[model samples]
Target chain A: MEEVVIQADKLTKKFGDFTAVDAITFQVRKGEIFGFLGANGAGKTTAMRMLCGLSVPTSGEAKVAGFDIYKETESIKKNIGYMSQKFSLYEDLTVVENIRFFGGIYGLTNEQIKNKTQQLIERLGLTSVQKQLVVDLPLGWKQKLSFSIAIIHQPKIVFLDEPTGGVDPLTRRQFWELIYEAAHNGITVFVTTHYMDEAEYCDRLSIMVDGRIKALDTPKNLKAEFEVESMDEVFYKLARQATRAE
Target chain B: MKAVIAENISKQYNGKPAVEKVSFEVDEGEIFGLIGPDGAGKTSIFRILTTLLLPDGGSAQVHHWDVVKDWRAIRNAVGYMPGKFSLYQDLTVEENLHFFATVFNTSIQENYHLIEEIYVQLEPFKNRRAGKLSGGMKQKLALCCALIHKPKVLFLDEPTTGVDPVSRREFWEMLKKLKQQNISIVVSTPYMDEASMCDRIASIQSGSILSIDTPQYLVKNYGNQLFKVKANDRYRLLEVLKSVPSTKSYAFGEYAHISVEKGHQMEASEIRQHLHQNGLTGVEIGDAEVTIEDCFINLLH
Candidate 1:
């Protein structure tokens, strides 16, 4: 049996009188590609924050990487990697410099950082542009590099927030290939994306609507349940039911 | 008559080409899309045609007015919602709309019909600050502000890039309604699926136009037999395609679409046999519909 890496029961967060995450309950196994999908203002960001130990849940219980949310938040942070489209690698740093910087931040030793920097640069095919500033690289290359750095410490899980937004179709698939490689190597991938086609790639995904988990299942199962031919149809059918203006 | 035209419009930044000899035309009252990924020069083309930036070479015209010589006229005739939400963030939604109307030497009531449908959605949040509104609401407010002047042509740069699927559908419906009122729209987006919503689309890449045609025409004329190949392991299936003697293969949703070589007599059974020998179980191969994304990737080659 696969090990459960993340378990949440009635996890809820509130801001004043408004509930951002309304008692979401789910379980994610190790080496699973778990998709956390929702619309804008659907509380995806807020829920992700709570799970990453950046924001405290207002109620309920949760454990990430076998660490309690409230008591072992620090340990949880160390056990997970995170990358968001809005924030990634430093723009002004060179390719090698950014990798070295992140490796050190993740508490890697001098030798580990050195070996990681070499392996990453070669793996990403950044050897030719290793000395170039990150800002000088193309958008696709920058995103791929940022993802590589996010898992530089080989965390058990990685959280990606719209990691492929605005990227070209071909390049986006290439990024997903990297994701598959990581999952195959026993890393859990929890990602949020607006792309409907990408939803089909996940082993199991949960769709959020108005701060609630409206549907949770594999893509094929969800489509069969919704009586739709494509994931896009399933998403439209679910998200259109949202009464919230956002 | 053409609503907008570009004759090899080019723009460069720091000796690097941002938009390279790009040329396209928008018919009056047509919804034309500049479909490409980020940094594909969509914004540069919009800026040039909207008279916000002068191209380094070639020329463009909006509503038959030269972009360079009649910059003021072009500005008055075009409504541009930049990729970034360029509004008075501190101002209330209502105030921003009124401000844009006054700047165009008109009143919101004069062009009320142009944005009535979209603004009605923003009515409840009219008093809310633009900065405090939600992402979808902010986009609506931006569209209302852009339409307050009743320009003949609208240039929306990546308006739906990060928008949700539902909101994206609504936004396109709004565009369809606006198009009916005789307003030409040139919208850019990174979503290949949205290509079908436009009357015509130009698949762009690295500052170059790959193809310009209606979505149907592009797909119908894709000129290759595409197959959706699926196996127990998706990534492994993708890797095995390298040995399948295909022209090109792309990962599309759940399946990897392989472009079967034209006139290649290899049957699907042979391909299945090869995969089964390669230890891929539960393999399925079927004819797949060609989408704009497939056309875009093929054009890239």
Candidate 2:
């Protein structure tokens, strides 16, 4: 049986009069690609921040990678790796330098960081331009490098927030391979994206509408339940039901 | 007459290529799309055609006005909504609309019919600060400002990039209504799925035109045995599919889209048996319809 990796019970967040995430509950299994989807300002971001332990929830019980969100935020932060729309790499630094910097921040010793950096440079075929500045690389290579650097320390779960936006097809294809590799290596992948086709890639998905989990199931089951041919149609049908105004 | 025409258009910045010898035509009163990912020169093409940027080489015409020589005429005859929200953030929504109308020497009431449907959604928030408006409202307001001048051609650059799905649909609906008024549309988007919504599209990559045809034609001519295959073990399935001779596959949503090469005749059941033989279980296979994304992915090769 697959172990439950992420469990949230009535996870809620409130900002004064606004309930951004209202009594939402869901569970993600180990090594599964769980997609969290919603329209902009539909509380998906708020919910993700809480799960990442970056924001305090107003009221709820949650555990990420077996760590409590409220009492063990530091552990949660340490156990999970994150990447988002705003890239976390330093553009001015070389590929090797960025890897070393991230490794150092993750508390790896000098020998461990050196070995990991060497392995990454070799594994991703970046040996030729490992010393080149990140900004000089093409967008696709830069994104691939960013994702590799994101999981360099091998966190229990990796969170990707719209990682493929604006990337070309070939690069997106390569990126997903890396995701599959990471998931295959026993890391849970929690992601959010606007691309409907991307939503279909997830093992299961939870569509949020007006701060609630309107639909949560595997892509196949969701399509079957919604009687839709594609994730785009399913999302359209659900997003149109939004009664919240931001 | 063609709404837009370009011949060997090229642009460069500081010794770097932005758009190469790219060319396409848009029919009058048609929804034409320039589809590509970010930095693929969609904006550069739009900027050059809109007379906002001077192309380093080649020539283009919009509404019979030379983009270079008849810059003023081109500007006067086109309504442009830049990818970014370029509006007065401090002013109320109504003030912004009024300002754009005055710049074109027109009044809101004069061209009221052109933007009435989109404007009604923004009416309640007319007094709100443009900067403070939600993304969907801000998008609608930008469209309103662009149409206030009643231009002959509308140029939109990635107008729906970050907007939510619901609002994106609404925006497209608005565009369809505007089309009824016989205004030519030249819009760009990073989303390949949106390509099908346009009457025609030009799939672009690496500063070059990959293909230009109606989405239907592009997919219809995909010319292959396309199948969407899913299994409990996706990683293994992908590995097996890649090793199969003459098989091309890419991850599409929840499943893998695979197509075989010519003369390599096969069926879905054959592919199904192949997967079963390879030890991947819970197999599901179906004939998948070709989509703009599949065509774009193929073009990228």
Candidate 3:
């Protein structure tokens, strides 16, 4: 049996009187690419933040990579990586400099940071522009490099929130290839995306609507249950149903 | 006559080509889409056509007025809603609408009929700050500001990117209504699903045009038989389907979409029997239609 890398029980988060995440429960298998789907303000970002140790949950219990989210958040932080919707690298820094900065922040030794930066630059085909400013790079390349920097620490799990929000189709596909490569190397991945097609790339996924888990299954099962031909239609059907229920 | 025309249009930023040798024409009353992702030069194209930016190479004419030579005339005849919200944050909804109308030497009451349908939605929020409105409401207000001038052409760039599903549906409906008024539309979007809503679309990638055609024509020429299959162990089922001889498969929801090689027409029963023999149970298979996303994936492959 596969190990459960992430476990949550009735996890809920509320801001003032508004509940962002309400009594949600789910588990992710080790090394699996898990997708978290929801519209804007549907509690996906809130849930991801809680799991990443960036934000505390209002109630319920959760574990990430076998460490309790409530008490072991620091340990959880040390063992996981996070990349937000916007590229989180300094625009004024050179490509190599940005990598070095992130590697240093993760507490790697100078020699280790240097070696990893070289490997990353070559692996991502960024050698030619290694010295160029990040702002000078194309948007696609910037996103790819940001993702590389996010996982540079070799964390057990990496959380990505809308990593390809505004990118084109071709670049988004290439980004997924990089994600799959990481998962193959035994790194668990948790990602959120508004694009339904991107959601289909995950090993398993859960749809959140109105601060609740409406559906949780592999992409194939979710579509079959919804009786839709594509993830977009599945989302449409689920979102409409949620509205009608309200 | 073409409502909008471009001749070898190009744009450069800091000596790097942003849009290179791009040219397209829009017919009167037709909805033309520049379908590409962020930094695919969609915004550059829109800016040039709307007379908001100057092109380094080639010339563009909107309603027979050159973008550079007759900038004033072109600006007066085109309505543009930029990719980013460019309205005043401090201005109220009604105030913003009135300001734009005044800039064009017109009044909200003078051209009220042109924007009546869209403006009514903003009526309730007339006193709300433009920045305080929801994304969908802000979108409507920006559009109203663009149309208050009663322009003959419209240009919208990724107008629904961050908006909700309902708002996106409603926004498209509004565009369809606007199209009926004989105002030519040139819109850009990264979403492939929106391609079908347009009369015609130009598929762009890495600053190049891949294909341009009507959505129906594009789908008809997709040239693949997509099959949807599922079993009790879906994760295992996808692996088995991927290894099947003469099959190109990918997981789509609770089923895997498989396209068998030419001359290989396996039925649903055959697939189910194969799954059963492979230690999989409760297998289900059925025919599936191609979607815009599917076609886009095929093109990428």
Candidate 4:
């Protein structure tokens, strides 16, 4: 049996009179790629915030990386890596400088940071451009570098929020290759994306509708249960049930 | 007759070309799309056509009015919803609509028929501040304001970039309804799947036009025998695919799609045998559905 890195039981968050996340329950196993999916305004962001310890859940219980979300928020932050498409990496910093900066922040020693910087630059084929500013690189390269840097501390889990928006198909696939490599090295991947095709790439998916977990299963099983040929159809069928207009 | 025309339109930023010799035409009442990844010059072309930015080279015309000489006429005759949220965020939904209508020298009542379907949804939130609305609602309000004038041409840039699937579908349906009113819609999106929603699309890259055709024609003309390959071990499968002797093989969703070499009818048994030789078992091979995305990637290659 695989070790469960994340466990949530009846996790709920509320603001004023509105229940943004309504009694959600799920588990993420170690090294597994778990997809958290939902339409906009479906409380995905709120739920993710609660799990990331950025917000306290109004009710219920959850554990992230063996740390209590409420009592051990700082430990949870240390045990997990995070990267969002909207923000990651420093635009003005060179490739090596950014890596070294992140490594230093993650509490790595000089020798460790040096080794990590060299390994990362060589693996990403950034040796030629290591001295160049991050903003000078292409969008694909920037995203890949962001993702690699997020896991520079070798956290047990990484959370990605819409990591591959607006990238070319080839580069998008290459980005997934990096993801697969990370998972192979025993890191849990928790991601949220608007692309249904990307939902298929997950080991297990949970679709949220009206702040509830409407469906959770493997992609093949979800398709079979919904009688659909593709994840897009499965999503359309489920998302149409949303009562909220947005 | 074309509602919009361009010839060798080009633009640059600090000496770096953003759009290079790009040319395309939009027919009256046609829904045309500029499909490409980010930084492909779609917004630059849209800006040039909308007369918001001056092109450095070539020329363009909207409704027979020159983009450079008749900038005021082009601006007044076209409805453009920029890629960003351009509406007055502090204003209420109805106020924003009324403001745009007044600026265009028209009233909401005058073009109520044009945006009645979309406005009805926003009616409930008429008193809500535009900034407080959800992303989908904000997008709807923007569309309503763009169509409030009932212009002959409409320009939407990356309107569905970060939109959810459900909202994206609803947005396209709204565009289809607007098309019935004889609006020549020129929309741009980075999502290749959305290309099919347009009547015709130009797959663009690196500030150049790649191919222009109806979505159906582009997919039908893929001219490749694509097969979906899967196995128990995905990493091993990807490595083995590098030696599959196929024209192209890449990871797509849950499986790797391989387009076999031209004039070669590679049997499933033979491919499975090849994988098994590489110690990859439980391999599955099936026909792959060719989409506009496939065509666009092929064009890039």
The DockQ ranking, best first, is 1, 4, 2, 3
Kindly list the per-residue Cα lDDT of model 2 for residues A96-209, writing each as its tens digit. 899999999888899998999888888788999999998887767777888888898889888898787767666788888898899999899999888887787788999999
Q: State the lDDT at B176 in candidate 4.
A: 92
What local distance difference test score does each model get?
A: 0.89, 0.88, 0.83, 0.89
Candidate 1: tens digits of C-alpha lDDT, residues B97-165: 999999999998998988888888889888889998877888888889888988899999988877888
Model 3 CAPRI quality: acceptable
DockQ for model 4 equals 0.67
Q: Which ten residues in a row have the lowest lDDT in candidate 1 chain B?
A: B259-268
Stretches of candidate 4 exceeding 4 Å from the true structure: B261-265
lDDT per residue (tens digit) for residues B126-208 in model 3: 99899877666788889999999888999998888766565577688888988898999998877776778999888776566
- Estimate how well candidate 2 is docked, as a DockQ score: 0.58
Per-model root-mean-square deviation over C-alphas: 1.4, 2.3, 4.5, 1.8
Q: Candidate 3 chain A: worst 10 consecutive residues by lDDT?
A: A237-246
Q: Write the number of the candidate with greater DockQ, choosing between 2 and 3.
A: 2
lDDT of candidate 2 over B95-185, digit per residue (tens): 9999999999999999999889888878887899999887678888999999999999999988887677788888899899888989999
TM-score of chain B of 2: 0.94
Candidate 1 per-residue lDDT, tens place, A1-246, comes to 889999999999999998989999999999999999998989999999899999999998999999999999999989999998675789899999999889888999999999988888888889999999988888889989999999988999999999998877888888998999999899999999999889999999999999999999999999999998999999999988898766
Docking class of 2: medium
lDDT of 4 by residue, B119-160 (tens): 888898899999988878899899999988889999999887
Candidate 4: which docking quality band? medium
TM-score, chain A, per candidate?
Answer: 0.98, 0.96, 0.96, 0.97
